[model samples]
Target: NQRVLVTLNGHPLRRGLLPRADGSRYLLFGQLVCRRLGLRVGDTLRVTLAPDPNPDQVDLPEELAEGLEAWPEAAAGFARLTPGRQRGIAYRVDSAKRAETRLQRAMQELEQLARMG
Candidate 1:
């Protein structure tokens, strides 16, 4: 398995081709990636891709880990989610500047997910 490094409009970044339901692969230019590269819809982008070594990499926040550890059901639910969903939760948990706020957000997110199931 290989990851990918792409240069979009001269702005370099690493990403991977995502799987489509129809069995095709596509690169998603996410909001953060687009904004960083000053890209917009309908704008032409020059993209160059190269093979990458590390693919399954995500930084799960410590506070979120603590929250998950304390909530077994939420932990299992989190484990059941796809890698993308897990990263989305990790992103939200890390968004807060304050540690207390991060913990609160992390716990809140787990509780919300628990309720959803």
Candidate 2:
């Protein structure tokens, strides 16, 4: 799998290129991206692609960071997770708009990591 930084009509996105059976690769736009860009099926786009400088980097929420700090085993477990999984978890937590919700999601992830350990 190749990670890429994509620019669609000037909007920046970080995404992974999915491999096809024919060995070609494609990018799948999520609903959020579609809505943000007002994209529709069969619509043409001006696309630019570049290699992701830090494909494995995930922005850890402060709440998640603190929780991980307090739980060494959970931190270790989190480190063991695949980059995709780690990004998924961090996205869940980071997407929460409210502070309380972010903390809640972070704690929930920490609990799951604790169980994994």
Candidate 3:
């Protein structure tokens, strides 16, 4: 698995290039990107890729950070998770359009993390 910056028809995306057993590589696009780009399976694309400069970087939303700060055990559990999992949680929280919703999602993630401890 290699983290990469991909451009599909001029749209920028951060993703990983996963390898198959046969040694071929492919990128997985999220539905949001697919819908935004009006893409369907098998659609041809103008693609370009490069190694991600900051592959391990995940943008931690303020609400999620605060939740982690208030729950030490949950924070520890979160730290134990894989980078992909942590990024997923942060993405979920950040995807919420409203502040209250983001806070709610952050709390929910904290609760789940707490249970994992």
Over 8-113, each residue of candidate 2 has an lDDT whose tens digit, in order, gives 9899878899999999999988765687689998999999999999998766879998999999978988999999999889878877768999999998999999
Q: CA lDDT of each candidate?
A: 0.76, 0.88, 0.87
Native RMSD of candidate 2 (Å): 3.4
Worst 10 residues of 1 by lDDT: 51-60
Order of the predicted models by lDDT, top scorer first: 2, 3, 1
Candidate 2 error regions (>4 Å): 36-45, 60-73, 94-103
Better of 1 and 3 by lDDT: 3
Candidate 1: residue 3 lDDT (0-100):
56
lDDT of 1 by residue, 1-117 (tens): 235888888876667688888988788876756665677889987889987655555557898887778888788788778777777898788777688989889988899767654
**In model 1, which runs have C-alpha deviations exceeding 4 angstroms?**
1-54
In order of appearance, the predictions have TM-scores of: 0.53, 0.67, 0.63
Q: List per-candidate RMSD values in Å.
A: 5.7, 3.4, 3.7
TM-score of 1: 0.53
Candidate 1 lDDT = 0.76
Name the lDDT of candidate 2: 0.88
Choose the strongest candidate by lDDT. Answer: 2
TM accuracy, model 2: 0.67
